[model samples]
Target chain A: MTTLPPPSPRKLGLVIDLDTCVGCHACAVACKEWNDGGQFGPLPDRDAYGAEPDGVWFNRVHSYAVEPGSDHAEGASNRCAGPDPESPAPKPGLTVHFPRSCLHCEAPGCVTVCPTGASYKRAEDGIVLVDEDKCIGCQLCAWACPYGAREISVRKGTMQKCTLCVDRIYNETLDEEDRQPACVKACPTRARHFGDLGDAESAVSRLVAERDGYALMPEFGYRPVNRYLPPRPRRDAANAPPAPPREETLDREKLPGVLRWLDRVLSR
Target chain B: MRPTFSILCFTVLSGIGYGAWFLQGLAWAIGPICEAHSAASGVPWELCPVAFWTKAGSMLALLFVSTGLLCSLGHLGKPSRAWRALSQWRSSWLSREGVFALLTFVPFVLIAAQEVALWIAVVRAGPDGTVALSGWVSQGGLPRRLLGFCLAAGSLATVFCTANIYASLKPIRAWNDRHVVPAYLSIGLYGGCLLLAAMTVDRSMEFRDHRILLTGTIVLAVACAWLKHRYWRSIDAQSSTTTGHAIGLESLGTVRPLEAPHTEENYLTHEMGFVLARKHSTKLRRIALAAAFLIPALLAVLTFVLPRVYPLTVWLALASGIVGLFVERWLFFAEAKHAVMAFYGR
Candidate 1:
């Protein structure tokens, strides 16, 4: 039952705009508030009042200091610096706030790795979820997830993860605008956009194309439905073009007409 | 990779248990070959009485296995829902391991039951040796060869499943390697041979050529020791991952953690962000190897030279071997670096 489903037409997911995210953690808090009262309600907590407080939450945010300029290990990471100079020579690092959650991968190892028919992906919306009733809580799904999406709750005796707000997203009773995920609704900067990514013409899909949105850890080949729109290049750096390649044929007029014709055909 | 006690206990006990079973099976299967060779040599050789050794060895393996399984039960959050673990064998290695482990019990139970019945038969035939129920209860001879085949197949497959469970995990670089499966197989075999030699040398006075058994064990120990050393060395040589690049911020230069998601350690940190100190891990590695391989091999040689101290030597060897396995398994979990650590600055 944990077997992956065939490719779905409606790959409903989020497109997080990293450039606009203020690292407020509003969405993260709202996610907990909404989910704690939803179907997978009241996320388990342990020693809440004790010295070491621990609990299960669907979303978490990480803050990273990114070093700008050269020495980019990955090709995708090479980008020009920001235009606004805080100083004559500013530090080469920019603070980046990263939010971590389930990617709703096309080939989710968490689902396949579950020994029980608990973890599953809906064919209709491609939202990966867990059935608490069926989960044995072996934590194998947690072990398999590269994104650290799954969380094991000792109190509930089950593994919990991002449900993509299935209950709220499809609820007919709620206002149409408020029916989206708690995280998206809570994002004050409007950095989070949710829609069918599989539909190439969808607003989210178009945003992805325009912003050059990319999947995280594409090398792992999970083909995550949720895409992240990378932070934009710095203002001045975006406009500045580095030294361009020189013209190979400096003396175009000096070349023989026959040779020039041959050259043109070869270049074409 | 937090070195949880339940999982550590499970791997240590089951690894040794299954390893011993594999050896027992090998001994049984190869016994006939030895006999034939002896016949060709015109020595009219006699084999050490393996009936008692086989029985005792199988029981010891079963005891360790049962205890290991019980320990794993505590690790699971929903123990009552444990039955659901067997439902996904088609895609899950854990399920395959569970199914294989259950299948393996059949052979162990059969062997243990037969051995017990044989002992009971011996007890019933009083000093006079003629008070027994004759051939009724002792109908068939212990089917060592057939049962040995079952033991070998079942135990090895189970170990493979265990190894694959870790090897298939793409997140942990240390675990998701070609070396993992072979390492598990090697360590399992090494542990088994150690247990077999310990039990055999301790319990037997009839084994004429203790040299052969001891020598084989010594070789395996030495080889296993070298393999573990190389494994540790290789892991050390590898460099840290380019995390700045991994998080899609490489162009920004170096990526460093500015703040963690939580003020205190959370589940992800507790579970995946384990980092063992280099100096301490190196020391532990040496200690584990010394106990598991070096000491056991030396003890085997010592027994060969001074058969009088055989009991002390073999028991000491067994104790040390078990301790070594615990350390080895602990390191396997503790030393592994998870990919999720890229975000947490592990």
Candidate 2:
């Protein structure tokens, strides 16, 4: 059963926009909160009140500093000037907030490497999942995965991973608007988009195409379904448009009615 | 990768077990065929004290194998459901290894039973400490030969499956190396030779009588030494996957970790993020090589010169080989850098 199912056309996956993520970690928190009591309940934390708290999490966020034009063989060129001659345009370093999770790869090694049939890919939706009942918790699937998506729960003695919120995505109990993955719904910046990536015309697919989204470590050949949109060139970059003037004051009229009232009250 | 004690025991102990079983099978298989030819020429094949020692060795081999299997259970989080692993032999190498490991017990049990029956049938001490067996004891020549060959083939095949479990994993560049399979096999067979030499050492037989076992030990020692050297050299030269590619940010320059997702080490880091100092690894490698390959090979050669202390030398060699192989196995897991570490900015 660990053998991969035939590739399905309805690959439900996510496309995240790196340029919009603020590294707020709301998505990761929301994921933990929703899944804590959902179908995959009790993501147990060891030493909850003590030092060195650790637990299983389906999603995690990492931030990195990306320096433009510093990817050369010569090494980091953080202070190097932009191409503008009249103005000394110092190239700025960009901090990219990266959220890591299961990519639901078409050819995920995690499934194939599983000794038990616990880890499997759904032929219906191309979503990878683990059957806790069958898992021996050998953790080989975790090692097989290059993404570090799988985690073994010490309390449950079974492997846990991002299910893409399978319990919520298709659940009729929840309102239609709230029936998507917890992470995708909780992103304040609308950075995470979820839909059928297999369909070329899907919004997530178009967003990927317009933003030039890419799979991480494609050289490993997992053929991940989820894609990440790279951070757009910063305003100070040589080819980017000129920066706009700074805003000196907030316009109360432009703010939403509730926010405007709150602003006025805070000002008083 | 973290070098868990249970996994090290499983691989090393089982490796030595299969090695001894393979050697025993070779003797059983070859002895019958050669005896068949000798009997056709009206000559009798003498039964020596080695027959008793060989049976004892077989029992010891079974003990090592079973203990190794038991140790592997400690590695599983859900040990009770370990049998579910045998359900996926069609695709999983680990499953295939489990199936083969279990299947190998068949030939072992069958051969051990045959040995016991033969001992029961021929129970008489001759003048020169040689046991005389009835001529009819050599009956069922083809069946015994077939079982013997099956035993050898099964032992090697199971070891092959075990090696493939690590070699097939593509993410760990160190484990995925080409030399891994051959290294496991040569080291395992070499361990078997050491065990056999120690167990089968008879005072009645001349030290030169152990030429085959000593020669095998020396050959495997040299082979394992060269294989491990090449394996280490290859892994050293291999460049790890870059951080830029890991995060899909290679177009931007030199990505560095600004902040980790968690304050404390997570399971990923704890499991696959082992770090070994270069100086420590180099020292350990030298120690492993000296104890495992150098000392054993020297002891095997010394058997010829100091034949009086052959028993002592072989036992020392076996002891040294097991300890050295344990260290080498630990390094095998400890030094391997998993690809997931790239995301952690390792």
Best by TM-score: 2
lDDT of 1 by residue, A69-144 (tens): 4533333232334343332343544777888899999989888888888888898889999998998888988988
lDDT of 2 at A9: 90
Worst 10 residues of 1 chain B by lDDT: B133-142
- Model 2 chain B weakest lDDT span, ten residues long: B131-140
**Every candidate's lDDT:** 0.79, 0.85
Best candidate per DockQ, number? 2
- lDDT of candidate 2 over A1-268, digit per residue (tens): 8999988999999999999999999999999999899887779999877899889999999998876554343333323543545544433478999999999999999999899999999999999999999999999999999999999998888999998999999999999999999999999999999999999999999999998999988878999999999988766455677779997988889999999999999999
Question: Candidate 1 on B111-218: residue-level lDDT in tens?
Answer: 666556756766777555743433322312236556667888888998899889998988877787777888888788877776666666344443532445577779
The digit string of per-residue lDDT tens for model 2 on B1-346 reads 9999999999999999998888888877777544554456454443544555566677778888898999999999999999999999888889998998898888777766666666665553433455544443442355566677788888898888889889988899999999999998888788888888888747544433257788999999999999999999999998988778899887787777889999998899999988973438999999999999899889888876777776888889989999999989999999999999988888
TM, every model: 0.86, 0.89
- Where is model 2 more than 4 Å wrong at Cα? A69-92, A237-268, B32-46, B123-140, B204-209, B277-279
